[model samples]
Target: MAVAAGCVVATLTADPSWAVQRPDPRPAAQPAQLSAPARPSNSDLEVVRLDPDPAPPGGTTTVHAFVANLGPETTASPFTITVVLPKGVTAQGPFFPTDCADLGDGHVVRCTFGPGLKEGRSATALVPVLLSPDLQLGTLTGGSVSVFSPDDRNERNNRQSFDIRVVETAAG
Candidate 1:
């Protein structure tokens, strides 16, 4: 076929000193090709709200919960902070005296806030949760508040979800 089309047009018109360039040892602080973290979306993190948004079903609700460790880098040490309770709520403590840990797929009732939390360091947890006057008014969905760490070694820490809302208290 015409000597293979003139040897591919003389090797693509080679003239740049017999071209075969290869000297990009790459290292100008090379670090941009990391696409595997786009699967975690929670709009980042930082939520703490518990105002007078309805609290009277028997009384007692002083939720402070104000966590912040938005981490740009500097939050590695134990790392834990959980709060999942809202189905007739009931969790009052001095912080770290847990005993209702069974979320093995039976809905939810987990409450753990311990060991670590200090990146941007905005801690402020004063949970005195209680709302069980035979609970039957309305609105008490799934409530949640989590923050974990320890991802690969597998000791437990790879849980992050946030959402909490409670309303319905004025039928006394």
Candidate 2:
């Protein structure tokens, strides 16, 4: 027996002295047809939020943007994570990936991660944020974090909204 293209082939042989002089009534064997392997299925990438610590107006803080693959398959392509800050906050870089791009006048940032993220594995982006000096002391809403990839098909869990609470600084 021999294996070829995911198929098995068998061969048989007989001695001439033991064989009758008659035509064999079996049909000839045909070559096996080979098909291309199927492509991998889509992955599931989710944004696991890690909200920033409360900071006073004009103070700086870090936003932990955690992303995970709740995947049945590993990623087959690269993906990107975007962080959008609220009105009163802005991104101050020294970002985790070092290549994270600041966009929309510092209120938004985009970070990239290479493929091959296995199930339960995660990637994180640390974005330093600075609150405006004249901002009010309260929860700053409208901030968001989102993920995108050609290998991910679940759109529902790809994005999540966040809030940055601004508090008053205590003087020692």
Candidate 3:
């Protein structure tokens, strides 16, 4: 503290031991380079639907939904298939994969297949469907099967429509 012209001034001086050390001017040493893991390859998936044999209006049938990898590479992630049935039709379980679930008013069914679907290999879901007893006898349209995957690159072959043919049960 100093006083000049009847005014007092206070100054501050940090001790050398209290001074912070300056960081190195050059960039710090980087960690050793590590190779990154290989990325999952893209795949092309195709969906096919096989309608069951004609059954009576009140009877049951199965829809065979098949998905194949038309890949230049094998899938490294899981994929899904969804079945949307027409009015008056419902999907029942004991489904293939055993994990298939009916969603939204019993008209839609979804099934999942895990990773490692090799190129040219395929998987299928057997969906049992029941027709309303009052459903008229004929072909029921508007039913579709679609596939989805984070790795599938082709959307053109991801979906297909199927028709359920209904016939009158023959008398014994």
Candidate 4:
């Protein structure tokens, strides 16, 4: 402390003849480029296309599914997944770890995962498909699936569509 004081005194006394300039405590006015920018947060959700399986007469077929989290953020809350079924296709049930419901309208099936999936993790589900009782050999179209979350970043991969053909078998 004494040495620092002596040095300060000497510096002041030596520069007495000239005016001493002190730096401004307040920051200098500068463009935004002078400051570093914050890093971008990643929150992405994706679902694979739902393919159809053969549901022959009185027999059931399973359609496998996959969901992936290719982001930097964790899904902090539960998120719902809706799989819109195509024509002539019905969701008998969804084999998933979470609570899944078949909306009975034959158009929508929903699944909710609580506490959500972590980043870089993936989940799978098996859906039981059957030919809508009245239809025989119809093309299934206009099918899609979406992951409902506010934090999703890449919308392109979030939803997908598929086409399927169901033919009536001898027993069907």
Worst 10 residues of 4 by lDDT: 1-10
**lDDT score, residue 98, model 3?**
94
- Residue 66, candidate 2: alpha-carbon lDDT: 89
Candidate 2's C-alpha runs over 4 A off are 1-41
How do the predictions measure up, each by TM-score? 0.27, 0.75, 0.75, 0.62
Model 3, range 50-163, lDDT digits (tens) per residue?
777787888999889989999989998889999999888888888898999988688999999988999999999888999999989899999899999888988999999999
Cα lDDT of model 1 by residue, 45-113, tens digit = 354544424565655564454556554543334334456666666665544334434455323434444
Name the TM-score of candidate 2.
0.75
Residue 148 CA displacement from its true place in model 2, Å: 0.1
Give the worst 10-residue stretch by lDDT in candidate 1: 35-44
Clash pairs detected, candidate 2: none
Model 3 stretches with alpha carbons more than 4 Å out:
1-38
For residues 78-127, what per-residue lDDT tens digits would candidate 2 score against the true structure?
A: 88999999998889978989999998699989999988889889999999
- lDDT-superior candidate, 2 or 4: 2
Q: What lDDT score belongs to each candidate, Candidate 1 first?
A: 0.48, 0.87, 0.86, 0.68
- The total of clashing pairs for model 3 equals 0
